[model samples]
Target: MTMSAVVMRKGGLELIETPIPRPGPGDVLVKTLANGICGSDLHAVTHGAELVDGFRAVTGADPFDLNGQVVLGHEFCAEVVENGPGTRGTHAPGTRVVSAPFLLREPQPVLLGFGGVDTPGGYADYMLLSEDLLIPVPDEVPTDTAALTEPLAVALHAVNRGSLGSDDVPVVIGCGPIGLAVIAVLRMRGIGPIIAADFSPARRAMAATLGADIVVDPRETSPYDSWRSVAAVSDPARFGRQTVSFPGFGFRPSVVFECVGVPGVIQQILGGAAPCTKVVVAGLCMEQDTFYPTFGVLKEIDLVFSISYTLEEFGQAIGHLAAGELRVDPLITSRIGLAEVPDAFARLADPEQDAKIIITPNAR
Candidate 1:
């Protein structure tokens, strides 16, 4: 049977009809219900070659060839169709599920819908996922909300990496989906005084709706400075003298999440951050970035970078959605069918237009 899918070509995305893939050993066929457009998807479409090079550098293997077209998608929720050979089919057919975007392979796992054309992602009408990776979505969780498991898992992982303390202040420097997810997760955990900053007014408002205690426009005031109003900081500017021997000595240490992956942001955070601050970088910056290590050292800053999530974390994200502990309705700004996926990608360029766009690939 043939199915429609959006393929990433050298020039741009192309919608075409292709045979629906049959499940392989230890794989299960799934019908795509909803898939969220991630920021990495935007980067992958434009920088596939660069991504391949980076992959080569990290794993010392060239797994992706930009010469061939590939499907791009990761965050998704689907329903079980059929179980392939050597599979237990943990979930019954027609059961809603979400899984980490990994297909088990010999040496290492291949990304479900990335790396090459052979591994199609959720951009298609149907996909084959590793049976072991599938997690059944609870009956109460809607399909669109369940699709958010991957990104929310990403946020949960980032928050875990931060190792926040009860007294530590949480500051998210970018009110994008990932940033907003972090805010939501923090609020779900009962973490308070969450500060979110963004240049876009729409995003700032979303951050507030998602449970940010304080939302600031970084253009008018630096995010580092805005936290002082709600929390105590050993500020030399306020006291006319450095009260603490080091950064964050007299007050709570700020755990700043660098969600904006553009260049120069790390450097800016290092320049303005308080002493003994921990900066967790969750954003994926593809290009080369510059940051002064000396500044970080002088301020006693701990810089950490985080990516992806563990299987446990992914399941936890789904559990949170099912229990209604995390409300993600505010982050979902638009929903489109597979035909609109291309235009939706274009609309995402303007932050004011959308926060999260869910693509229903099988929609008629």
Candidate 2:
């Protein structure tokens, strides 16, 4: 049987016809209805080798090797249409569900996002997966809406590490989807006065809509520029520009979440945080260098790295998003069908798009 898919060819993407993949033992055949184009996909397409799932590095491997038509999406919310032999009977047809993205096995573990480095991705009509990873999407949640669970999982994980409570002042240093989710999650927990920093005014504004107390554009108020002299580097473009053009805002946040994944920003956050303050590197700063342990030791500050989410964690994320505690639907600025995947990726990669963009694979 033929299936429609967004296939990645040499330096470009094309919707091509491919055979539907049958689920293997311990696997379920998921009919992908919605997929989110993650920043990692952009990094891979541009860098030719982005970190798969943020954990392992895959280089010139089978799926990512020179000439393979690798799938390009990581965050997918789909439904189960069929099950393979010996699969658990727990899953049923037409179940509203969001999966863990990858399957695992004994002896060899399945890393949710990165393990797909060698396996076909879920950006197609049918994604094969071992039963252990898939979970019910939940009632009252449409696939387009729940597709956000994956990124939300990430945001929740970061928040969990930040140790943010209703009383803490939280600051997120990036307005990407995950960054925005961080702000929303904090708000849902009754955490107020959250500050969102970004170069994009659109993103900053979106943060405001989501519940950010203040939007700081480092382009104008670079986080490093002493707040006393924050106006020196003040520039509107710093907050929403394509690059980190601003000096930075003040350093009063007891808990800092770095989501931009830029080395300089990470450095700025690390050096500027108050002694004993905690810094959660939410965004992957690939170029970040190790700081002198003495700084952390002397300041009594803590640095934690948050990658993916666990089962319970992912569930908590969906609960908040579904319960309306975390208002995220408004952040979904655009939705397009399969044919628009390429363009969607382009716009998402571009700095102009406003809020989180969701790809409705079957929107057409």
Candidate 3:
């Protein structure tokens, strides 16, 4: 039997019918329920061909060639339909679940939605997931909300990498889904007053709803000025010139989350960071980006590049959702069926269009 799926081809995404994938040893077959459209998926659609070159430049090795058909989706929630041969019944059939997107086969890493062109992902009606990567979603958490587990894990991982302290004031640099997720995670951890910046008015508002203490439109006002103003009112002595430290200068954000993965945002953060601040690059930038090393050196800044989350972090994300500690319902802007994926992609390309567009493959 064949299944319907939205496939990423050389030209663009295409809705097509393909054979339902069977799980191999140590794998489980899953029926896709809900899949969240991620910024990485958009990047793959627009610049997939350049990904190989980008990876080569970064790691001095071509990770994978995406010159063929690829199934694009990583943030998703599904139902386990079958357990393949040689797999223990750790997760029984009929369990709702989500998984880490990385498929490690021997010496190489195959990213579920991006690296392997033919690897079935959440964009389809069915998918084959490694048993090791599967994380069960609690009964309290709906599949639609569980679809956010992956990105929330990513946010948690980035925050973990930042090593935030209870007193550390975090300034999130983007209000996109990932950036918003960062804000949510920060709130759950009781680490605030969180400051977030974004050029989009809609995103800034969303950030405020997600618990950002101060949301600023970087276009109209400098985020640094906003941070300083908050710091001045909160604690004037801490903002004193002589006592102010490096990296954060007079600001209190010792840890900055760079959620906007663009060309010049890192440089902007570097220039604005005080002497000893830690900047976490949580956004996925598939293309080349440059930042002057001197800026980091002068400030003695610690730059941490974070990618996918750990297995433990993935489980934690699900737990947070299950306990109702994380709010993802607000981030879901629209829901579409499989056939609407191509059009949804087009709509999402416009930065001002929507926040998170979820594809309900089985929805009639």
Best by TM-score: 1
Which has the greatest lDDT? 1
**TM-scores vs. true structure, each candidate:** 0.94, 0.82, 0.91
Model 2 lDDT at residue 123: 61
Model 2, residue 129: distance off in Å is 2.8
lDDT of 3 by residue, 112-230 (tens): 87644246778998888888878888898988899999999999999999998776778899899999999999999999788899988888888998899989887877776666666
For candidate 2, write residues 37-123 as lDDT tens digits.
Answer: 777766666654434323244333333542557677767887788888888767898876777666655666453333222344656
Candidate 3 residue runs with Cα over 4 Å from true position: 59-64, 104-109, 115-118, 232-253
Point out the higher-scoring one by TM-score: 2 or 3. Answer: 3
Tens-place lDDT per residue, model 1, 10-127, is 7388888888888889999899999999998888777777777887988898645566678888999999999999998588999999999999977888887674445689999998
> Residue 253 in model 2: shift from native, Å?
6.9
Ranking by TM-score: 1, 3, 2
Per-residue lDDT, model 2, residue 131, is 75
> After superposition on all CA atoms, what RMSD does each candidate show versus the true structure?
3.1, 7.4, 2.8
Model with the higher lDDT, candidate 2 or 3: 3
- Could you tell me the lDDT of residue 124 within candidate 1? 91
Query: Which stretches of candidate 1 lie above 4 Å from their native place?
Result: 115-117, 233-244
